[model samples]
Target: MSRLRSLSPATDEVLGEYEIAGPEAVLAAVARARAAASWWADQPRKGHLLRWKREIAGRSDELAELIAAETGKPRGDALLEIMLAVEHLDWAARHAAKILGRRRVGSGMLAADQGAALEYRPLGVVGVIGPWNYPVYTPLGSVSYALAAGNAVVFKPSEFTPGVGQWLADAWSAAVPSQPVLQVVLGAGETGAALATSGVDKVAFTGSAATARKVMAACARTLTPIVVEGGGKDAMIVAADADLDAAARAAVFGGFGNAGQTCAGVERVYCVRGVYDDFLARVTALTKEVTRDAYGPMTIPTQAEVVRSHIKDALSAGGRAVVGGAESIQEPFVSPVVLAEVPADSRAVTEETFGPVLVVNPVGDLDEAVRLANATSYGLAASIFSADQAAARAVARRLRTGAVSINGVLGFAGIPALPFGGVGDSGFGRIHGADGLREFSRAQSVTWRRFAAPIDLMRLDRNPSALERARKLFRLRHAR
Candidate 1:
């Protein structure tokens, strides 16, 4: 049997190999999930999986090591991602029923004699294509919510991190024990596409925008509904009155955390001209002191070339690297590089450079900062730093993104109540909280005819006088 090797990103060491799933095997997994979905949905209210959520939380250390070995991230970073995933899983289990339960609705005047209500029904099966960066957190965004909403999930983790994916599967059976509620399919992109077109009820994908289009096209064959969480060229704005030290720390984490391979990771910054020099000085000093050549490697091998090219493009177009230069993108690992005065149209600024790279520019004022921030095709996430809480919130609200943090970056993702997704090229649909629970369920409207109207308007033998009176009453009540 052919096997897929799970190699370490930093050392290129083979961690383990798993049997690769062909198209037939992929379909079989979905079939099994389809068969078990009804029983799983019938077991109890979907929210009863709270016990399973706890089980996942309990084994964090074991899973964290697997994450580090597979994805080449530091163990501490892997643990952090696992803890955050546990938080989201807990929230989903606790709130799914409230978010997806049926509720009564008011009937309009035309249907005054009718009683109306609505229900959110679970889709039988869901296909999830998860990304490699922050593997645990990204997959949990869809997997936890899908399970909470009463759907069985067939997860196709990134080929780079199949070991992490298998770890999740092991935890799933320990919690449930009776049914294969969550299944893992190991392979490359073909496996993911197979799941999408394999007659699943819905597909939730997280990855680059370029691949999102391909997933959409595959799902189109079966007309399966899909929710894509694509890449972003996220930005942060620093106001003149902002705390320089705090903003610098935020830039370091937002731009370089997880080897800068995050979907909502910060890639650019717009600073108020009054504090531009001070902010740059603080950022440069912090970047040099804290950044490391071995922080972590790019999970995907091909991403290093992309990062290197983006660096060269920026430097060749008159941008200056105040911190790391063009050679910063070493094989396997990409060192932190901060570019200054990069042109707006340069590929470094316009595209999603999934590396530890930051492009900071000076703006005349808050207006200019907001304008420059909104100038991207991506609307995934953003951050704003300012002394005035009111002013910072106001600017944060003005930027076009799915979520924004005041004086921080990526903070909204940790809060389970916020809807996480984006518009435009960043892709559409949502995950997390009430919106996510509803995303995996379908709405069903139920109405009952309580009684007949005063006049028999639908009868063929209706009297002219009664019809005239009904018209007059409707006109008097509605037209006035």
Candidate 2:
């Protein structure tokens, strides 16, 4: 058995240790969860939903503290996770009947005598491999919706934030009080792999694209369905007629919040040349005001090197740090840094640094800005700041991504009504709203005969004469 990995803040030198469940143990627990899922799913949907909400709400403070300690986020930010998650759970519960309930469908002419309907059924057991950053918000997007859709989930939390995962699992079970529909498997990559191949119904993974590929391959061995919410190099656009102050705040917070470990965090910015200088000054000032608290360390310690490399590459490529340059780093927490006049081909522009770094580039106009924003392999969430609603929505429609915010930043994720996920390399499948509910449930179609067939159309024992009679009747109706 592989030993459990230690967890530590990006700023702290000493590592805190926790024992990881071995692959065998993880599989055994998953098997038990699969067996228990049948009984859990049998419970009344409304009852289950009420219980989940009660659990989340009752222990709100404890959950918030656990989230903050595990991810090194501020208390307010941690509370945002709980708030957003609760909203999603509430919305999903209230709307699941409309989204997942059986609906009648028109049958084709050939089968008009039969009534057909479609419904969404839960997958047997879902494997969720969560990321360390935003341990509460990120994974809850998957776990909550999956549970609402009636699937049992075995969540493998990030090694750095196993305690948060355990807390959630324990709380959920406390509410349910009977079945362990939601279980936590604490381990590193190997345990995740075991879960992927553990004959599970499906896998919902959120992480780097490189790791997503590995997850896909592993699930393929078991022929299990999977949804990948891989990382993104998302971009933000500032139009000439946009709100400069709002755009600056959005950019700074979107880029540097959570120490910039967000998969959908703003990594690149494209601003119109007309307000480029003014926008740059405002953003630079905001960046100066933004400081990392010593308590808020790097959520993922290993990512420090990647952050350093991205900054070094940008500087080497002649990019100037208009606001924060090489002087930002102390140890673990990275001071928010803004890079300006960076080349489009630079690493910071093309790759996901997953750090508190932003690369701002000047564009000729709205057209050029849209082009620059859509120039990455990722099609995750994006932001467009413009006063022209028509123009903003038009540009947003053209961009290939899961969600887009017009005249606002990161507001799409806040809305519990809109679907959240990405296209292209950012990985497919949603984790919020209606899209999130559908992700965990498989579409099931059913048909019932309203009346007995006049002829033996479906009977394998039918003779050629019956087929000829049917053909003659069809030809007589449309011979003209």
Candidate 3:
């Protein structure tokens, strides 16, 4: 068996080594999950999930350290990610029954003598392919919801963060040792591909859109359903009436946090021309305060080069670096870089630069801002900052992204009730709230006859009068 090593992107220290799960191992894991699915689905999943949540919470610090070590995010940021993940777990556990339980359905007037009901049933097994950035939070967005909805999961975490994934699975095993309801399979893209086509009922993948296509293709052969949360080139818009200070602060944090590894992190900003100069000044000053060491090192080392290319391209296109320029990229770490006056068509504006960089451009008005924000093929998440609540909300409605934060940045991600995902190149399907619980399960509809119909419409021999009566009823109901 091939072994995979998890190393800290910051210090290059070996975090842990795991045996890579090949195609055979992935199939075995799927089989195990299939075996556990029925038993897990029948049990009181809330209790199991709560116990697992408690286990994670009890060792939150240890888990945070492991996350930091594996992902090169600051310890504090890792802790925050853990805390948010725990909150989502708790929410899913408490709300699953209410959301997925069988409920009476209204039978139409024509079927008044019948009783109908609907419920969501767990898929046999789910294969979750998680991303390296936000390894804990992003995967658990699917894992916690899937488990709460009573599906057994075989998770294949990103090779870069295998230790963190193993920790999560170990915590589950400790919490509920009766069955291996949740299992982690370690490896790189091949293992992920194996899991995708391993006959799991569904696959939940989070990563680049290009990689998502490969996962989709593998699952296509088996006709397995998949939910993809592809990364986004998200944006932020500042209106003329917006709070410059608040917007600038949010931009700095949203753009540079986690070294800009966040999929929904602010990559572009459109400022209304009236406040463009002041907003630019405020953003530049705040960005300057963010030193190279403020955030953790680039979790994925090669992403540094991508960041460099974007800055270089923007500069060559006549854009000015208001803050740290190309010099900000130091091997493992990239300091905050904010570019102003970048051309609308620059790769720095159009493509997703998954590093600590932001492109700021001036727009004539909020309408132009909205137009530019929606112009991108990606519609993941976005932010609109304005002091006027109605105006902000109106602008928010016009943005084509999946979720929008009004007067703030990324607030929707923290709210477990809100469904998260995107349209267009950002991918489809949601991973939280009611939609998430239902995403991992299939809906079953049932109808049973309560009493016989007076017309006896089922009999062909005596259907003449019944047909006339039915036609009368249909005309009365449909002739709006």
Candidate 4:
């Protein structure tokens, strides 16, 4: 078997080695999950899922340490990510039954003599392809919800964070020792592709749009359904009547938090002319105070060059680096880079840099700000700051994204009830909340006759008069 090694991006220290699961191993894991899915789905999953959640919560510190070491994120940030994951797990476990349980539906007038009902049934097995940036929180968005909806899961964590995925699977096994309801398959892109075509009922992928396309293609071979949480070039909009201090703080944190590795993190900002200078100054001062120790290194080494290229491109295009420049990228670690007056068309503004960089641009008014913010092909999420709550909500409605924050940034992600995903190039399908639970399940509808109809329209020999009556009734009821 081929072996894969996990390393600390911060120090290049070897963390642990895992045996890569090729196509056969991935198929074996999926088969076990398939066998387990039948038994697991029949049981009351709420208790089992809650117990698993508790187990994860109990060892959160240990898991956070593993996540930090593998992904090169600060321990505190890792803990925060775990905390949010636990909250979401709790919500999914507690609410899955109510959201997916069978419910009676009213029969329409045409079928008045029939009774109707609807329910969501789990897909037998789910294959999850997770990302390296958010080793824990992001993947759990799918894993927890899939398990709660009563589906067995075979998870393939990112090559850089396979340890975290194994840890989660081990916790689930310990929580429910009787069955292999959740399992981990370790490897890189090949392993993920194997799982995608491994006959799983559905695949939930979290990664770049380019990779998402490959996964989609692989799954298409088996006609397997998929939900993709592709990364985003999210933006933050500052209105003239916004709170400069709060807006600036939010922009800085949203842009640079998690070393700016977040899919929904703010990467672009459009400030109305009224408060552009003040907002820019506040952001610059706050960004300067952000020391190198505030966040960890870029988890992926190649990402440094991408960040550098964006900064260099923006600078060459008449953008000014008010905080740090391309020089800030020292191998694994990238210091905060705040660019002002960056052209709206620059790669730094239009694409997902996925680094500790922010591009702030001044707009003529709120309309221009909205236009610029929505101009991007990637519509994942956006943040709007305004004193007028109604106007802020109106702006939120106008934006073409999956989620929005009125005065804050990335606030929609924390609320478990709100479905999270992107639109356009950012990818499709939702995870989190009611939508998340249903994403892993297929709806089953059933109907039966409660009584015999007065006129049997189906009887061909004597249906002429009945059909004429039916047409007259339809015209009376539906025609104007």
Q: How many backbone clashes does candidate 2 have?
A: 0
Candidate 1 lDDT tens digits, 87-143: 898888888877778899999876788899998888999999999998899988999
The residue-by-residue lDDT of candidate 3 on 1-480, one tens digit each, is: 899999989889887889999999999998899989989999998989999999999999999988988888888999999999999999999999999999999998888888999999999899999999999999999999999999999999999999989999999999999998999999998899899889999999999999999999999999999999888889899988899999999999999999999999899999999999999999988987888676789888789999999999999999999888999888898888999999988989999999999999999998898899988888999999988999888888888888999888889888998999999889999999999999999999999989997666666587787889988989999996
lDDT digits (tens) for residues 165-234 of candidate 2? 8888888777777788899998989889999999889899999999999999999998998998888888
lDDT assessment of candidate 3:
0.92
Judged by whole-model lDDT over C-alpha atoms, candidate 1 comes out at 0.89
Look at candidate 2 and tell me the lDDT of residue 26. Answer: 78
Model 2 TM-score relative to the real fold:
0.94
- Measured by TM-score, how close is model 3 to the native structure? 0.99
TM-score for all models, in order of appearance: 0.97, 0.94, 0.99, 0.99
Clashing pairs in 1: none
Clashes of 3: 0
Give the per-residue lDDT digits (tens) of candidate 4, residues 1-480. 799999999898999999999999999999999999999999999899989999999999999999999988889999999999999999999999999999999997778888999999999999999999888899999999999999999999999998999999999989999999999999998999999999999999999999999999999998999999888999899999999999999998988888999999899999998889999999999999997678889999899999999999999999999999999999899999999999888999888999999999999988998898899889999999999999999999999999999999889878899999999889899999999999999999999989997766756586788888888899999996
For this target, which candidate reaches the highest lDDT against the unseen true structure?
4
lDDT of each: 0.89, 0.84, 0.92, 0.93
- Please say which candidate is ahead in TM-score: 2 or 3: 3
